[model samples]
Target: MTSPLSVIILAAGKGTRMQSAKPKVLQTLAGKSLLAHVLDTCNQLTVDETIIVHGFGGDQVKSEITNQYTQSSFTWVAQTEQLGTGHAVKVTLSDLPKSGKSLILYGDVPLVSCQTLAALKAANTDGMSMLTLTVDNPFGLGRIKRDQNGNIEAIVEQKDASADEQNIREINSGIYCVDNALLHKYLPELSNNNAQQEYYLTDIVKMAVADGITIVAIEPEHTFEIEGVNNRQQLASLERTWQRKVVADLQEAGVQFADPTRVDIRGSLSAGQDVFIDVNVVFEGDCTLGDNVYIEAGCVIKNAQIGNACYIKPYCVIDRADIGAGVDIGPFAHLRPDTVLSDNSKVGNFVEIKKSTIGQGSKVNHLSYIGDATVGTGVNVGAGVITCNYDGVNKSQTIIGDNAFIGSNASLVAPVTIGDTATIAAGSVITKDVDSSALAFGRARQVQKNDFQRPTKK
Candidate 1:
């Protein structure tokens, strides 16, 4: 509830271990780029100002973010060189005001909680508050050097630590909440005096301690919250960690998971009570599930909302779709953009619905493509039925009234309609609208051939 804070995320690493053409920060975990996760976390913290310091693939990173978050209040900072972590922050932090403190994070470590960050902000005072934790082996990490009273004195890197310091468990997590005014005052004085010729942010702790400024070291709520992703293996490990954590959270919220490990939720997923999610479900973008919704395994839903009691079967891809209550979708269905199904409607296996609106209790079952159509209630669309929505020139629509029955192998060429209770016979191609209770069969009647003669072979 304090004033919105500033945030700077370092995302400059090339991530050579990933062996990928794309930058590490641009690698996707749970369907979003790694840096997007960090930016989203910052937004969740109500950070007034956020900056992304990009080094490797900086242009692509900036373009992707700009395309995705057109209205977000964030500044993109470019770091041309692959400098140390301290130099990465220093170069891009110019956009921030010199007066307010900031919460710094790494783009590769995206699962940090805002609650922990808020606690760090609460501990931020005259100097800085670092997100610290004790590990079993702090050999390569900078040890947290404290005074007799247990106050953080200085941080010593692995090579700089003495024999006694090697046994110390508490270490720097590389995440901090520092006083911006003080940081700005001493930033220019930072020198590349280390063996690697890289500036050290840890030096600020010594400066603050010598000047009698307070430095607080708060432990992270979860140890994995600060874990960094260096390769595909690590990225995948963290992705699973984040997904499993979300599954656990949802399980606590009364969501029944068929197989927790197989589900992947990329963006925000809000579920009502009694929602059931099956295995291998990848939910991207934003999705909302109403009460009693049953999602079967291998369902990929995105930018879609499922109504109460809707059953989404296996291998269903619902994107940019909206389903009403009691709807049943697919064992193999693709509900594309602008598709909407009313209550009690059914789209069975091998069915694809695009830019169509199916009315209540309608059925489009098996081997069908219903695009650019408006179907009324109680419509029975048999197997292998298709609405020929696309002509050589432009797309068209097929309108069917209530209780209309379209038989198997029927192709209803659009800009066409069928009146209420009209029946189209099997293998019919409907090119014009039919009247109520009429039987429309556009195909020619059967003609028998007799006495067929065989021709001589060439």
Candidate 2:
């Protein structure tokens, strides 16, 4: 039988190099905190208990985790001092169970896969196991040393390494799996005599060797999985790497991207078959695009549910909107929150829709502002139309019945209605309801002024 697994995540560093007040682990990647991404990978291993050792900005970390994961079964352990990695784990020893294995992870390293963790856990079934990687540049990293027989020996920190030792490419990843009982037994033996004058966890490797225990060293297939972020540059590099993986997966699922490098998915995006996305498009929050949907370049869509066969032209910004099938939207349209467009609706250039609903087969074409309104089916809202739904203090509604036709430059004041099949003449400012089948005219009548216009150049 396998022992139960527990996890300890180290997130105590102040991250001064990041030049921000937030803790290093709280830095964001792919719309979630870096610590959140590590926790997500940990969740896949089904560990019995998990602990986070937080120091600088610990309160903010606690509050954020509580808000984002209300149901998470994780315990918080405070490392009050800024100490080394070994000390961080030592502070959490009291919270760990005695009868299981403990996996040590770093919050800043978010790309480590669950499969690699499972392999580490399996290897630690007998004794200690550490994840190690070999890279071309090992500058600022700890080097791994082995004996002539190719057996594990000890880890040498970069500052303390000799000229020959500095040439070694294999480096320690700072991730480990150990028997819980042995971990508690050896943590007290760590010494703070290294160059940094901090208690180093690598010393435990020497203790394991002295006790005749074999330490298993496991290497990940990709070195990027073990990369850690310390500054803005590294954070951006990792973000791009993660994005490339996302784009590859989407491509495998039959989603077409005109230029995959120019697309960004900051949140969850789900698309059906035959979906096309152009360059420089950003999909944020939770978005679902149905089959045959087409999104043009430079569009930013957030929290939208777009139905099948809809075509969204370039430079549109949509947020919290629901659009139905066969809809055609603009090259420069903005759909704000609570807006809904029914099936076969058309919203054209430079139009903005806010907190409104447009019924089936309706068209709001060219330079219109529709807000706090309900427009019925088969209506034609002409160019430069505005729904005057606000009066400084409060907002009102403008309801247009089925088959209504609103002419160009019309301003329909709110708390007003236009009955079915009604027509409002061009340049009208409608302030009252119009009866069905009526042609309402509100502008001043045109008059010839040839005899009265001699007051020009004074």
Candidate 3:
């Protein structure tokens, strides 16, 4: 039988270089905290227990993680002193089960894939394994030292390395997978005798080598998987790298983009075949686009479902809306929450819809505000139309029946209904209900005067 796995995430750093009050792991990349990314990745693995070691901003870290992951179980360990990485893991030892294997991870290195971690865990056949990388410049990093027979020996930190050891190209990624029994045995024996006078987790490599254990080194498929964020610059760089990967995956799934670099997806975005997304578009909070849907530049869509063949013009904001097939919306329109557009409906420029249902074949073709209303099928709402659905304190609903024609600059006061085939004259404000096939003119007629004297300019 396979032993269970435990994951230990180190997230105690203050990240002084980042110049922020929040903890380093609380810093955001791709609209999520750095630690959130790591926790999300750990959720994909078969982890028996998750232990997080926190130092600075411990309460904030615990609160955030607890609130975000209410369903997942986690053990929070506080490191009172900021000794080193070795000490960080040492704090989590009390919560770790001693029979299975444990995987050590860093919260700031948020892009590590689950596949790489699983491979690292599987490589721990002889109780010890670690992730390593070979780079062009290994300066200021811990170098992996090997014996004369090319067998793994130890890890030499940059400050303690000799001149010959400093030139090694392979560096330690500081990620390790070890047997829980060995961790309990070796972690307590670690000493702060290095040049930095702090316990180094890499020192365990030497201890394993002395006991005749072969240390397996596994490298991730991408270098960015091991990248750590220390400052805002590195955070931004990783953000772009992550976004590039997201765009690449979408492209592979047959989504077309005008300029992939100009788009930002803060949350989940799913697109069907033949979807064309233009530049500077932002998608947030679970948006879905069907086949042949065309989205123009500078549109923000959030938590909305757009049906097949829908055309969204430039600078539109759609939130929590369900749009039917063949619907056309704005060059500059706002469809707020609870708005539904039926098939073949058209919402033209500078229109705003809120809590309303526009029926099939209906056209609201100009500047208008339709809120708390139901517009019937084949209805035509002219320019500058307004549904007066609010009365300072309470909101009411306006219902327009089938084939209703509302003229330009008209206001239909709510708690009213316009019947089937009804016509509302231009610039009229109807406060009462109009019967079927009736013509409602709320404007007063012009009165003629026989003679009037004109006043001269002062």
Candidate maximizing TM-score: 1
Please write out the lDDT profile of model 1 over residues 232-326, one tens digit for every residue.
88888888888888899899999999888889999889899999988889999999999999999898899998899998889999999999999
Ranking 1 against 3 by lDDT, winner: 3
Separately for all candidates shown, the number of backbone clashes (residues 3 or more apart, or on different chains) is: 0, 0, 0
What is each predicted model's overall lDDT from 0 to 1? Answer: 0.88, 0.92, 0.94
Task: Report the backbone clash tally of model 1.
Answer: 0
Tens digit per residue, CA lDDT, model 3, 1-458: 88989999999899999999999999988777999999998999988999999989999999998999999989899999999999999888889898999999998999999999999999999999999999999999999998888878999999999999999999999999999998998999999998899989999999999999999999999999999999999999999998888888888988999999998887678888889999999887789898899999999999999999999999999999999999999989999999999999999999999999999999999999999999999999999999999999999999999999999999999989999999999999999999999999999898987787788899
Q: TM-score of each candidate? A: 0.95, 0.88, 0.90
lDDT of 2 at 368: 98
CA lDDT for candidate 2: 0.92
Task: Tell me, by lDDT, which candidate is best.
Answer: 3
How big is the positional error of residue 40 in model 1, measured in Å on the Cα after superposition?
A: 0.7
Q: 301 in model 3: Cα distance from truth in Å?
A: 2.3
Candidate 2 C-alpha error for residue 95, in Å: 2.7
